[model samples]
Every structure is written in structure tokens, then in C-alpha cells.
Target: MPRAEFDKPVKVLIVASPYYKDISDNQIAGAVAELDAVGAGHDIVHVPGALEIPTAIGIAERLSNFDGYVALGCVIRGETTHYDTVCNDSSRALQLLGLQGLCIGNGILTVENYAQAAVRADPKDQNKGGGAAAAALHLIALTRKWGNSGQSVGFASDILLAGGKTTA
Candidate 1:
């Protein structure tokens, strides 16, 4: 993982879900505190549940000034299969957004029981929210590096750079 660029000013948006209000709130707080420590500017947004985080992040990506996004939510399994759908779909959605060059911090917790969820929600334990924020910040740094190096434009050691012509 790359170090946090504490010297640079970065803007982050955190979206928390209210489904598992207790756990989600804890995660969001963890994210906020961690980002604050890194000297980054941030905003907190609330949504209905895990399902809504991806869309909120999508909107954030369209902003020209926002540097990154953090999605925090907790989904505890129940007797029904609803948990699987929410967890899987939300994870894939956020991953897709990130792959498209959207800096996303995914903190969605999908666990089989309350105990499992509690472990992650605890500030001292996994604290996945904090981890996610760090990841987003790191990715932002990498994006800046790649953008500056011009490596993101094209391959350097390839014949394609010859304007579709080969030396005779």
C-alpha cells in the first residue's frame, strides 16, 4: 500500500447506510476519524442501506472536484437470502465503479451473525471502514502518479507508437 499524501489536499465523500444503523454508524465514524487524521477534507452522506451506496458513489464520481469516495454499511445475515443479494450486488457495483477509475473505499460488511459484524464495526478490530478510506486515499495518490507520468496514455515500448507504420 502507498503512504498517505498528507501534504496534498484531497476531498472525500463518505456514504453510510441506515439498515444496520448501529454498525453502519460505527463504521462511518471510523472512516471519518481516520480521514480527518490524514488531513483530508470530507463530507458524510446518509442513504437508506447498503443497496444505495453504489449509486451515491456514482454521483460523487461525476463531480470534478471530489477526489474519492468511501462507502460504509453493515449487512447481517438473516434466515432469508436477501443478505446475499445485497452484499454481492453492492460489492460488485462498487468494484465496477472503482475499475472505471473512480476512487472508491468499500466498507460494506456482510456477516453471518451480529458477533461477526460487531468485530468489524469495533474501532480497534478490523475497522474495515478505516481500511477502506486508507485504500481510497492511496489509490488517489497512484492515480496522480500515473496521470503525471503519462503512462496512462499508452504503452511506451510498442510498435503502435509508430503511427501504424513499420520501418522498411
Candidate 2:
């Protein structure tokens, strides 16, 4: 069994969006494989759709012991604005968690149509879940480093150092 030894072992919650069960399943499977590669401890939870991801995330955050989170979902665009709402809201929520050093990896997909969704939903060609898991690992590393830093660093400062720059 692969195992990772962290300065502080983190409990992670994988909140999967159940909107598109098939896609979500693929996402979860990939996420699990990635997590297994890192040998990190994790639990899986299911939500109705992308909209509910944040609520689940909030629960994980409040647990106060988890080192990070991974959000997995698929939202194929429809004729309505529903797609926009779910995608934006879910992304923002994860960003908020990241800002708080919650170390969340998001694998939610906003596709133009079912065909495109299907393409990215493939476990082989589309490994967004794995990408998200890797992101979580990096975030965990960053958080551990910043927490131990003697110098006080703000959230924006951390983001900037993490190779993120604001475009204005």
C-alpha cells in the first residue's frame, strides 16, 4: 500500500456531485487513484449536484481536523442559466476554502454540451480528478510550510508566492 507521511496527517473529504452520476463516478475513481498514489487518508461523500458541493465543503471545513478537501462534479451546460450558477458558485466556494488554507482540489467540469462533457469524462484522456488531487497535495505542502513560517504572511501573499498573479 502506498503511504504518505506528513508532518501532520490530514483527513480529506472527497465531495462528489451526483448531478451526472456516471461522470461523477468517473471523477471519484480518478480522484481515488490519485489519492492512493499519494497515500493520503480520505473519505468520500456525495451531494445532489454542483450546487450542494459548497455545503458539504462547509461541513468538512468546520470539522477543524481535515487537512484538505477534493470536490468532484460535472455540470454540462443547458439552455438555462443553471449551468452558469452552479459552476461559478461551486468554484467560488472552493476558492474561499483555499483562501482559508483549507487546501481543496476542485474537479468540477463546466462543459458546453453533453458531447464535450463525455470527452472530458473519460477516465484516461480526462483526469481532472487526478489533477485536483495533485493540487490538494501541493496546497497541503504550502499550508504546512506557511503555518511554520515565523514571518506573518497574509492569504494574498501566500497566493502570490504560489505563482498566482492578479490581472488588472
Candidate 3:
């Protein structure tokens, strides 16, 4: 993935659901690696399940000084509809938070089985957790480019370049 360059120092919060211990651990590892690469400070918060990640992030956003957030978890499809509810509700809440101006990178895996989650969660393979962290970093860079209001006010859009450089 392309890199997001920060003009200012950043701190990130990682809200993770470790329902699947091994899978969630790998995801967290990938997310941490990405944050470390960008020299961002990060801390992990464990929740009971995927459903709680968004709420944890929301609370952090309100009370903490994090510049960005990475959400990591796994929701594998089982014999019941519980999987769908967990997947949809968690995702929708995260999206709502994003729409409200939070820089969140969602890494929740909604897979059909353990195998799929394993493949995607593996930092050496799909590295989805890393990808999600990158997404949040990009948004952070973009947010800084436009200033804290997060609404582009100029008549013309700024052509963003690497490392948060932009030309109007």
C-alpha cells in the first residue's frame, strides 16, 4: 500500500476484540508494526467482542488525545445469524463514527471459517491489519491537509502529494 506521510507527530489507539485469541493477536501485531513504522505512539485496548470495538474507540476519541485509530477483530460465520449481526452492527457503528470525523481504520474480519481468518490475519500473508492501519494513517494525513474542520472550504480541491504536501 502507498504510505501516508505525516507533517505532525501522531498518536493512535488500537481497539481490538480478541474473541479468537490467535487470530486477533496476529492482527494486533500487524497494526502495531505499521504504527511503529510511521513512528506513531499506540496502545491496545481489548474488548469482549467485535461489537464493542466501535464503542471503545468512541470513548477514546472523546476522552483521549489520539490522532488516529485502528480497529482489529475477527467475526467468523457460524451456524447462526449471530455472525451477520455482529458483522453488520459493528461495521455500521464504525462507519457512523468515521462520518462524524473520526479517523478509524477497521480491520474486523468477517469470514466464513477459521482458515480464511487465519490467511487474512497473518501479517506475512494478507496483512489486513497492516492495511487497515495504513488506511487510518492516510486519513490522518488528509485531515491535516484540510485542517481540523475536516471540511474542504476552498473553491478548488487541493492536489495532495506525498508526505502531506499539497498544491491548490
Winning model by lDDT: 3
Question: Candidate 1: misplaced stretches above 4 Å?
Answer: 150-168
TM-score of each: 0.85, 0.80, 0.87
lDDT of 1 by residue, 51-168 (tens): 8999988877776468899889888888998989999999999999988998888888888998998889877788888888888888888887777775634444545434686432
How much does each candidate deviate from the true structure in C-alpha RMSD?
A: 3.6, 9.5, 8.6
* Strongest candidate by TM-score: 3
Would you list the C-alpha lDDT of every candidate in the order shown? Answer: 0.84, 0.78, 0.92
Q: List the residue pairs that clash in candidate 2.
A: none
Better of 2 and 3 by TM-score: 3
| lDDT (tens digit, per residue) of candidate 2 on 71-138 | 88888888899878888988998888778667888888888887776667666877788777777777
Candidate 3's C-alpha runs over 4 A off are: 148-168
Q: What's the distance in Å from true for residue 33, model 3?
A: 0.9
- Prediction 2 global C-alpha lDDT: 0.78
User: Which digits, one per residue and each the tens of the lDDT, describe model 3 over residues 36-76?
Assistant: 89888888999999999999999999898998899999999
Ranking by TM-score: 3, 1, 2
Q: For model 1, what is the alpha-carbon lDDT of residue 98?
A: 89
Model with the higher lDDT, candidate 1 or 3 = 3
